[model samples]
Target: MSATGNRAAREFRAEIREWLRAGLTGEYAALRGRGGPGREHEAYPERLAWERHMAAAGWTCIGWPEEYGGRGATLEQQVAFHEEYALADAPARVNHIGEQLLGPTLIAFGTPEQHERFLPPIVAVEELWCQGYSEPDAGSDLSGVRTRAALDGGEWVVNGQKVWTSLAHEADWCFVVARTEPGSVRHAGLSYLLVPMHQPGVEVRPIVQLTGTSEFNEVFFDGARTAAGHVVGAPGDGWRIAMATLGFERGVSTLGQQVGFRRELDALMALARSNGAIGDPLIRDRLVRAWIGLEAMRATALRTMDGVAAGAPGPEASIGKIFWATWHRALGELAMDVRGAASTLTGPGHDLDDWQRLYLFSRSDTIYAGSNEIQRNIIAERVLGLPREPRP
Candidate 1:
């Protein structure tokens, strides 16, 4: 907050932009769609190449400590880096789960051995990982997950299916939650384990999305084996571990989306003004509301990062998820109106090509990680101290 700090942060941003412009080349730009030369891509190698480029710069894990292949950036530095990268139209980083969830949880809870094994490559983009928490019947109620993991001669044998797993088809590993003990109360018998996806009995089946592109998968395990060393916490202790990861997912990961989405929102506003939608009172009011919501969400995310940096989880993290999801949805709506009939789905080169895809994707914002409905329940019961609903 100091003037000196502001100057330093600004200088850091300038340095990053200069570096990105120089090294963010035509081929990489074409692959990841930085400028007009690159706009459309659906290749894994391209994303990997771009991730490697950023990781080598110590810019991949911007918030991570210097010891773990990161730059030991401050919270402001991380946010600024995200925004600046996004505004530059840099290619998307592939190891989002690593940088956002797994790395943070490992930092918080992993043993020195675990940290030494997992942290460096993740920051260096050497390995890809995915979440394996949700099951067929336990999408929203994470406590209800029934994937079973039984200890067999010191190794855990896991058997179950995880639906809606993002990037598991290509992920080298997954952080799975399974019922280590059956017949125990919900949330009590579960444990978190990191599974190598390439091993036996782990199958990743991609599920096609509304965009005609598959970004998630259905992972089935029939006696998948994981070492005892892979366990995150004690058996029958996954609830708290998963909650910690979710808190980070909602707090940290959501902030990344907010930073990126705010740029899109700004572009949307700019387009709206150019299209004369700014003259309409209703459209203007909605845009004003969106801008306000974005500012509030960013502030809340800042507080959450501060909490994480300070070794304390902020209570406002839950509410911030709901706010940003809703904020993005609103922007999507405004984007459609601004685009007019162009919102009608069309192939690339269409006036609203990006907007249409984003609009559909925004619908899932409230559903993934944790649904907004679940978030509201947490707010009502935990934050508001409301009486719990009576059980059947």
Candidate 2:
């Protein structure tokens, strides 16, 4: 970047830093460190209010185009925004699915009508969104989805079950990938439908995770209805649109995620020192490796964001997913080791400490989004141009 760009970025950084420092006071002050993966239950109502407060101030969806209720922030500005937000320890966002995933997908693939209806609510945080891609029979193999949706009158009637749906109970809408053609299989005959979540045909059952939290859920959609025009792309083109959404999923917010990782590593190192775990050379070595891994993850993320800036990410996004998921899961293991025997115990009423929650929740990092196995397959087949895996 030129000196002019540097100066602008510094100014942008300072603006957000001052805003966060000033806004995170009174009621918002307690929300600074609340609400994230496995801990979405933390002060959620307040967090929702806080996000709206941000939306009202034009802080949400800064990476989108100005016409789409965003600031039309450049990639550099977006990175600076996320980095400063993390550094401020602001509450984890409540509308990540809508802002980061669906909004971009809509901007790239949605029609004008779709845009006019959806983008404003997302920008305003008026509606929360969730993803409905995984099914009981098809987790990471997205093409194997068995959910079915068919046109009925002027609406699409959806029927299926979606498992491991994050924040489903809280979401007012869901972007679902379902089979639209009767005989279609694999990646064909699918359509991406945006369905409402509060209808009588929709039921959200919370799934208890290792952290004993209900952030993940199983959603049953029976005769759930959406407008005929709610499809993101043309029918039978959902595979492409869904993949694009995944690309957006792996985009800029990851820089903020890395910031949180750095914080976790720092706190764990401090705990190790206090608990004498640092005396163990093996533990010390793991801590050092964790720090090194975080640096590598950040570098890879910045490089990948270039592709995102150009357009939707390609198969190369899988590389960063595999790296961060594996690194975070390992960090969890190291957290347990750092805690020693205390890792096994729980407080009265089975309460878990922050370290324990980290260990348990990080276990799913490799599984959700896309599993390690799925990510490697994507890398081998798509990124590295390896031969396709033999199918039965």
Candidate 3:
């Protein structure tokens, strides 16, 4: 370590790394660790067990408040925990969206009653939550969501469909946005609602992916009624609340994937060196570029996380997301180049299909949480002080 290196950071890493090396050693080798997001059965007992163990140890959410199922660790410590988990190859926490997005959002904008009811379960991984932001015509443009919720019999009757709801079919509940007033502006009419999954009027159908797996689903609400108490924040306030959650989606809480990219880059280097693919300058050059991309992503993500913790809302978060998404595509291309035909071949367990599936999944990252093109627009107009482009 350098003389100027932060001692607190080093100490935190040491403590977490020791526990991880001991806890993640054997019998759980099937654990993907920081291998990035993968398809797993919803309500998988084993995955839930691992998450419970982490929560019990106060590691599941390092930065969450102590009263709300967290360690109340420093932001620096939180980053250290994420890095250590990735380095130790521990399985990713099962209910990341609940912990990452919903938890933070509720902490910021939820009422005391709502927090007391939902926060604990979210930390315990007992209640899985899916986002219901994107509607049929609203993927990247979240403000265009047209799902309607009306007041009826002292309850909110939601009648609309949500597409691209990740794992909603398996979730115990969902945090959804619905339009409450027809004449209000796009962002002003929205309200956030929490609806249970086992209701009579709700329908969920899985959408299978190219990897021959089903994870995300389409959710339909046919006069699905929810109590007034389930409403988050206030009517016409969901836009601001959703933006809070989206900040987390693009901030420190979502940096796990970037860490996983490090392990992948390492694995690629080993594969190239050991398999004699390094003999060709073409292969070597691609490997170098891939490694550089991973490093760039880590640096940018870490910096943006620090800014987020400091309460500075910076546009740089989009940089990491965009860069990492592109890196995934580039690595997939390189992986295919290295393995020639095996890269395209989908085989059983632990094959190149993992990379291929990740590649396909990365194709969605740019489109979700606002598309990369939209992010570029924001950077040009909002960040770089450029003139706004007129919308026809």
Candidate 4:
């Protein structure tokens, strides 16, 4: 908040803006406005190429310590970078899971050997990561993870299924949460294992979504294996480490996501005007509310970022997950209503246009990462100091 910091932030923002303006042209120009939530399938090879380009330019993992091949950007600087990236319409990043979530977790809890082995590949974009937390039976309640892993020889053999894994098929590694203790239940006796995705025991089946894209997948681990040392933190500490990672999941990148949301809302408002929806009092009111909600979300995200900047996010971070997820879902509804009847029909092959895809994909916005119901529970129990919900 000092004058020096303010000047630095402004300079950083300008530098990022200039870089994006210059770099987004040439081969990457066509990639602008592609590879977001519902559109992860768009220009994937090109996006990977863009990822390597960013790594080379020192733009990837900007929040990580400079010793780890990152910029060691301050929280404000990180926010500025993301906001500028979103404004530039840079392709949605391919390394978000690795860079944002796993990277920080490793920095905090990983051993020196683990850091030396894992951190470089992530910074270099040599290895992609997918989270293995949600299972068919345990979506929001992470403690209910039934996937089991056992040490066999020098490796841990993992066996279970992880559902709704984002980009698992494209990932080289998966950070898996599996039960390591025999007769373990709920949050106990679990281990957070970093498992390789290319081995014979693992299988990835893409789950086609309503938008006709498969950004998420069902990963089956008949006997997936990771080195005994691949476990982050200690055995039975998975719950704590996993909770920290979830906190990271809702960190500064969300500010960037809000920038994207603002752009989407602006487009939706423009659509409403062009389609005469803005002439209607109801549609116009919704658009105004959407804009106001976006501003509020931005403010709240900044307040929350203070905690994220200090260290791994705590329970209060749930506030952000609940707020943004609900807001985005509502925006999707607004997009559909703006489109009116056209939202009902697709061009061909059930192909969805942008608005339609927005509506459909946004439905899961509340569901994934963490569900609204789950988020409310976290806020009530963790943040508000309320009584825990009674389980059946």
Per-candidate TM vs. native?
0.90, 0.99, 0.91, 0.98
lDDT of each: 0.78, 0.95, 0.77, 0.92
Range of the 10 consecutive residues with the lowest summed lDDT in candidate 1: 32-41
Pairs with backbone N, CA or C atoms under 3 Å apart (clashes), candidate 1: 33-38
lDDT per residue as tens, model 4, 215-325: 999999998788999999999999999988998888889999999999999999888889999999998998999899999999888888878878867778888888888
**Model 3 weakest 10-residue run by lDDT:** 34-43
Candidate 2 local Cα displacement, residue 342, angstroms = 1.5
Per-residue lDDT tens digits for candidate 3, residues 1-392, read 35444677788889999877776656554564432344555235666777777777766767788887787877777778777777676775668789888988888788899899999988877799899999888777787888899888779999999988877876999998999988776678899999888898899998877555666789999989888878888888889888777778776644556677776777777877887888889999988888777777777777786666764346666676677767786776676677666666766674436668766666676776678887887778867889987764
TM-score of candidate 3 versus the correct structure, residues matched by position: 0.91
lDDT of 3: 0.77
Off by over 4 Å in 2: none
**lDDT tens digits, residue span 96-161, model 1:** 888888888888788888999999889889999999988889998887888899888979999999
- Candidate 1 regions off by >4 Å? 1-4, 31-41, 251-256, 274-276, 348-352
lDDT of 3 at 234: 87
Error of 1 at 237 (Å): 1.6
Clashes of 2: 0
Q: Distance from true position, residue 73, model 2, in Å?
A: 0.4
